[model samples]
Target: MRAVIGIGNPGRNYIGTRHNVGFYILDSFAHKNKLDFLPTKSDFWKAESVIDTFRFLLIKPTTYVNNSGLVINELIDNFNLTMNDLLVIYDDVNLDIGNIRIRKNGSDGGHNGIKSIIYHLQSDSFPRIRVGVGKQKDDESLANYVLSKFNKDEINLIDQKIPLLEQLMIEFIANGYEKMLDYFSKESNTNSSNLS
Candidate 1:
């Protein structure tokens, strides 16, 4: 089975926050596909379905952001999934807001969620889609910045790219990952998104 893990904190209190973009993306995709996220024995909300005989599971880790790797590990074992079969969707502050990056594998950079995943799995060889939340302002508290909701302009920026984000997610599902990276990379290049 193929699993896509969207790393973010749980609870209604976190909705619309910059840190919750991962959850937002997964929820949007699930809604588009007519799937409902149901509570699972695993530490995440899960939506399971099959598309053209390919089993797919969408996960939103309820373990919150910092300990995401624990939920990921559990899902892997429960689903008999390998690292290569998983794609993590997450937020990044390095890229410009509304930008997206796709990669087959790499270091977590400074992302605590990714760091947790790498620490738990002891490996970084997995696919990931990073949505840019833009760099924090110099005087802003990192924690405060990420946990805050996107401002009106930022929301407008991301809103314009939602369709493109959907396409990128679907590309991974339809074209498989290796080629999907190339596809997104090329797409980002032409559009100034920098899919690294």
Candidate 2:
């Protein structure tokens, strides 16, 4: 079993903020696969779907971003899953907009959600997919910047990128991380030539 946990604040107020891109990506994946993420008794919006032999649990925590670990830790313990079986997808302000980085393990790098997960899991060995939200100008407050919605131009780019992310998730589950990385790393060139 594998778990794909997308971290973000839960509420209508946070609907389209950069911080909620993780939820958007996961929602896209679930929608593409015909999976419904109805709320469960565990206080998470979750859905079960299988890609080949891998059974995946797609989770969006209702505990909000800062307290995300509460639900994640519960899922980990209840499922008896190891760190390797988990893949987190979240926004990263440090990365350039529209870029993504996949890592097997790493520190939270100042993400409150990731920090909470690390605190609860007591380890930093889980795999993660970091989606770039871009850094704010020096004059902008980090909180305000992250909570802001994307501009029309940025939305157009994100519209294209989301499907690619959905494909990557499918490939990551069906094949493995390396193959998914290879495909996504060269996505621009492939897309230019009309190849998926």
Candidate of highest lDDT: 1
lDDT of 2 by residue, 1-196 (tens): 8788998888899988899888989988887789998898896899897887888889999988888888877887888877777788998899766677788778999899999999888888887888888899999999998899888887666666777788878777776677777877688565662222
What's each prediction's TM-score?
Answer: 0.93, 0.90
The residue-level lDDT of candidate 2 at 22 comes to 89
Tens digit of lDDT per residue, candidate 1, span 1-196?
A: 7888898899988998999999988888888899999998778889998777778888898888999998877877887988888889899998898888788778998899999999999999889988899988899988998999998999787777778777766766665788677777677678764445
Model 1: what TM-score? 0.93
Q: Give candidate 2's TM-score.
A: 0.90
lDDT on C-alpha atoms for all candidate structures: 0.85, 0.83
**Which prediction has the highest TM-score against the true structure?**
1
